[model samples]
Target chain A: MKRGSLYTLAYAAVLGLVCALTLSAVDGFTATRKAANARAEEVRNILTVLGVPVDADAAPQELLRVFEDNVTEEERGTRTFYSYEHSAKGFLRAVRFGGPGLWGRVEGFLCFEEDMRTISAVTFYRQEETPGLGGEISSSAFTDQFEGLSAVGPDGSPGIRVVGDGADDINEVDAISGATMTSDKVEDMLNRTLEEMIGRDGFDG
Target chain B: MARADKQACATCGKGVCDGKGVVTFKDGVWHINPVAVQVLGICSALAVTNRLENSLVMGAALIFVTVGSNLFVSLLRNITPRRIRMIAEVAIIATFVIVFDQVLKAYYWEMSKQLGPYVGLIITNCIVMGRAEAFALSNRPMVSMVDGLANGLGYAAVLAIIGFFRELIGTGGLFGHQLLSEAWYTPNQLAVLAPGAFIALGFLIAIFNAISGANREEGSQR
Candidate 1:
């Protein structure tokens, strides 16, 4: 073997070994922490959507505690949703959802009122839209508008719409001014997910 | 070998305290500052400086990667072949970047989300490669490490200043805290966006150049 080629091979081998070792070590060490964080975030999101008063800076333990005390996971047939009993109302349901966003998948939890028809809140957990534009889908200014809006009409049709701001429709929420595509996609996501939920045996009233 | 000789040695020690690596420290910290003096690694400055928290984290990440890659590059300087040294340097730089990325994702999950694609983009950051090529490739490991750290700080300092103004004015807050009274002051919405970053960075760069220029003149006088 040529001397330089031999050096190159040695360099490549050592570099590969070192890189693999470092990456694997980090991955192993962080795997549990990452999982715990994801779980805590999910718990927090569920609580937020359910209107279960969670401090934004609450510890993970506190979040888990709140989630356990207030929320219950209900399974019917092959579908599952988080349920919380309201004092005045019957029960609220929340489902985790994900769909195509402008840049990537947008994922969040959508909560419903006791009737399972009115959207109580919507919280996006992950989105890849533009930060100031399409990214506003995650913003409360946009998501908050979905509150008290009907997810389904009187005839059981999906009536949710992402309309321009200030249009007179009870079923429509304002689209983010510059994020028309993201708003439309979010509307599509909600309608599609709600339709699927309605088709399931447990979701039908 | 008497009392006078001992006293003389003590004074000399104090006078020459800058010793071996002090010049490297000085170079990294101020005179040859990576961001201010060399004008490298401005992408993260623009992207992360919208918020102080993001800038601080980005700075620390840059420091970790830069110092790590510099040390490794300097260590392997002798053995690395001329033809493929860039490739070797990139491998080392990328390994550190990924390690930093994984650590952030694991520990500071929210921050990882906020930073989004910037952490992974560290491998492409010009400052890391710039330091490795210019200093680490020729220097000893210790010096290179110092250079790396100094450059990271320089970059971080600039980002922090930019973030301070952007967050304070754009959002009427600091680190998302509502410092400005809402009823009195309204936020400049433009400050939170990309074009705002460009304008803020431009003025900051101008101020930095003026200060650095003055420092240069003072150093020349000395």
Candidate 2:
């Protein structure tokens, strides 16, 4: 049977309305849980960077509790710092850093040991680089290289280097092969954050 | 004709167990598998098959979307206007896809991050739309659901196989567990790249075609 134009229009309207309602209901139902999960993920990243012990399988609430009990959050000069007092390592500080990546914004936490120049850990919790290439920045193989590296160059510049070739400098780490653009962007962003951190006084204490 | 049988089955309500249902199941899972045979929805198959976990989750997502959309489409098949049917189908399919995506983001945040936009891209996967247009529009709701499940399984099975080989060869592991010792086996980097998906899928389709071709020959002779 042929459908009249009126019937077609009505059918379209009804279907569109139903679909909209369904999506809205689903979005409403999941909004709270999704927010909690996102918050938990951020907390997990902060805790991991600050050298605080975190359960790998901790729930959202559990992770928040750990963050509260161990890490203290303070805002200083537009940058929020997460500080943890480690018995062996002394005071550790972690600050959020973000900038333009190859595809989108690359964001992560950069932590420092008590000395303020010694790297503690780096975690690229958010990035949109090419998988298997630039995407490796988030992988432990890449991030682990930052551990024990100095934020200051041998020349006393307040930045680290992401070298394309083998890293031979005290402040340089090997950039991911075949991801030159992403490497350069990450280098710029890290340096930008490092420069700002170093220029500020009283941070070392 | 198949069309006649479909109309009869739609009215009979016994289509699920009748010979038609068995044929539909076989056709979907093996004879005309979505990925292996028809080659529909290969985009997600390639993107997610790099890891077994991602592939399985993607497959589950497709299964959920297809089954849900097919049931709704079949139920409204009669009243749905032909001119607006495609739009209606898309609206229905998109709803299911978003629901799955939202739930994944809420409950399985890590996996959701791994999948990224691929879960949202399920809205454009032709397999879901094709099944709705071709089978659900004609068959009974129950039979259409069976068809959806079968097709989903077909897609999922192919993805799992590809994922298994890719992860094993690429990373010397399965589901992130190290299976091959680094001392003995060096991971083939190519297997983890985009090209690796093409090579694995190509081999899978060839093997499937060869076996099905042989089966057809034996059946004709019998």
Candidate 3:
């Protein structure tokens, strides 16, 4: 009813309207580009793990080109995975898999050698872990250790182990020092998620 | 030199060419630099300074938010009710922050992802709020915009220097390229973590203080 209160309410309403409009316009303009970049990044990550050696500075179109030319999607029962084969090199298979991370779904691709028992590379495309701590799991420092490591043990058990301090086994990678939960989650995912995928449809190496 | 006249210029009307506005604008950025001097938003400074790409992107985002919010706040300063001014300022700042976030997500998705929550956390950065209240609310639009930009650069400068050291020494790389040969050099892992950031920042602040102090002596004479 008061004059000043009416002005304040009108002011708030107008400000809110303008903000909504601005944000919507920005969102509209950016949505497609964001999706495209995300797709390119996914392709790039897969290409990297496949030993295809994607240049980080390569254009999005170039990355897509490589992906289209080199990668083929295959189905095993209900599961789908990517396989890369070259005339010089034998065959490399990659699976895009993840489970719950410390904060949210951590999604990434893991590529294996033709033998299917050794991990050739592991790359995380998305993770919601604490920065500089658990988040380091995606860094090459951590993922590089997975390369050339056995994902399955000699006696047919979960072979990948995450050591909290230091690791001395071929199948072990040192965990991030300050990120115990995230490291543990990664260890669990490696052991469980990979096995679940393998059992779900009996993936043929 | 004129004390009485200086006080009068402080209350000059908007759209006026008063030296007070200019001086305060400069002061907000320099003599009272947000990061080095005032130490307002050090959280992002440390977190993002581990790499040059991240620090640059974060700095640009902060500049965009600060300048955008300052301009908007100055434009609406006359109409914004006193009782709810803080709320209005926050809403305006958040809007710009989201715009920055969306732009990064669209164009620089990798950098955007690396920066992560820090981009969204700009709304909570004290420097933005500090400038909005201390400078923008009571100044002309142009002055407020300049003030915001200068302060953003001040913060950026510190972040970049800290980033340079962290990236160079911690990773033996600059912006992810290995600068030091592995055979001849090894990285200081401590510089890759938060404690390293604190140590780097402390030394930087001390160095900046000494340099600025010397500069002030010459500045006063001129």
Candidate 4:
């Protein structure tokens, strides 16, 4: 049947209203759980990078509890540091860092050992890089290279390098083979964060 | 209608006078399978099939969206104005997709992250919209739902097959389990990348066509 303009407009308005209501109901139902999941993920990353042993299967509440009991969140100016005292590694500090990536923002935590200059671990908890190429930044093959490496360069500058070739320097790590732009962006972000971290008043490198 | 169509109609329940449920199911699942037969919705098929779990979840999401949208569209089919029907169908489809995405994010946070925007992209997946337009608009709600379910399953089945091979060959594992020992079998890294999806899908389509072609010839002879 042919429908007039008035009927079509009314039908469209009604359909739009119905969809909006349905979406609003679903959003309301999931808002709490989504927030908890996001919080738990952030806490999980912070704990993992700080070398604090939390169960991989821990629930959001459990992760939050572990994070609260073992870790201290200290705010220094604009930066927030998550510090943990491990039974084995002694003391560790992790800070959140992020920068514009090739596709979107890439964010992660940079953890440091007791000496403040030596790296303990790194985790790219949030990134939107290409799945197999730039996305490898989150994989252990890439992030594991940060362990025991220095955040300071050979010239005493507070920076790290993601080199394409073999990393021979104390602060350099190998870049992902086919992801030069991502690697460079990662390097730039790490250096920017590192500069603020080590060059600041509290840190003595 | 033909005598065979009349006979089929007699067997159907009320409001399903055409007895298209079984036919729709058969068409969606196998005869005109969404992914394998029609080659529709290949983007998610390729993007998520690198892992078995990812493929399954993605498939489930599609199934939910398609079925829900089809049911809603069919229910409103008669009253839906011809001019705004497409817009109405889209609104219903997007609602279901967002609902699935939200629930997935809340309960299965890890899988939600793995699937990423692909789950949200279900709104644009042609299988859901195609069924809503081609079948649901003209069909009863029950048959429309069956069509949705069948197409979703057909798509999911193809995805599972592709995922199974890609994971096993690419990483020498199924669902992240080590089936092929590193000492004996070296994983083909290509199978884990995007190109692997195209290769796997191409092979699957070829195999599907060969079998179906042979079946058609046999039926013709009979």
Best by DockQ: 4
Better of 3 and 4 by TM-score: 4
Worst lDDT 10-window in candidate 2 chain B: B213-222
Stretches > 4 Å off in candidate 3: A1-3, A75-78, A86-89, A101-105, A113-118, A128-136, A139-151, A157-183, A202-205, B1-17, B176-186, B210-222
Q: Tell me how candidate 2 scores on lDDT.
A: 0.91
Give the best candidate by TM-score: 4
TM-score of model number 4, chain B: 0.89
Q: By DockQ thresholds, what CAPRI class is model 2?
A: medium
lDDT per residue (tens digit) for residues B79-154 in model 1: 7877779989999999999999999988898899889899999999999999999999977677788889888888
Clash-forming residue pairs, model 1: none
Better of 2 and 3 by DockQ: 2
Poorly placed runs, candidate 4 (over 4 Å):
B1-17, B214-222
Instruction: Report lDDT (Cα) of residue A19, candidate 3.
Output: 93
lDDT of each: 0.84, 0.91, 0.84, 0.90
Looking at model 3, what is the TM-score of chain A? 0.79
Cα lDDT tens digits, model 4, B47-104, are: 9999999999998999999889999998898889877788898899999999999999
lDDT per residue as tens, model 4, A59-124: 999999999999999999988999999787778999999999999999999999877898889999
Candidate 1 local lDDT, residue B116: 85
Docking quality category of candidate 3 according to DockQ thresholds = medium
Candidate 3 lDDT, A115-180, residue by residue in tens: 777788888887979977899998989999987888766566655889976887677889999999
Ranking by TM-score: 4, 2, 1, 3
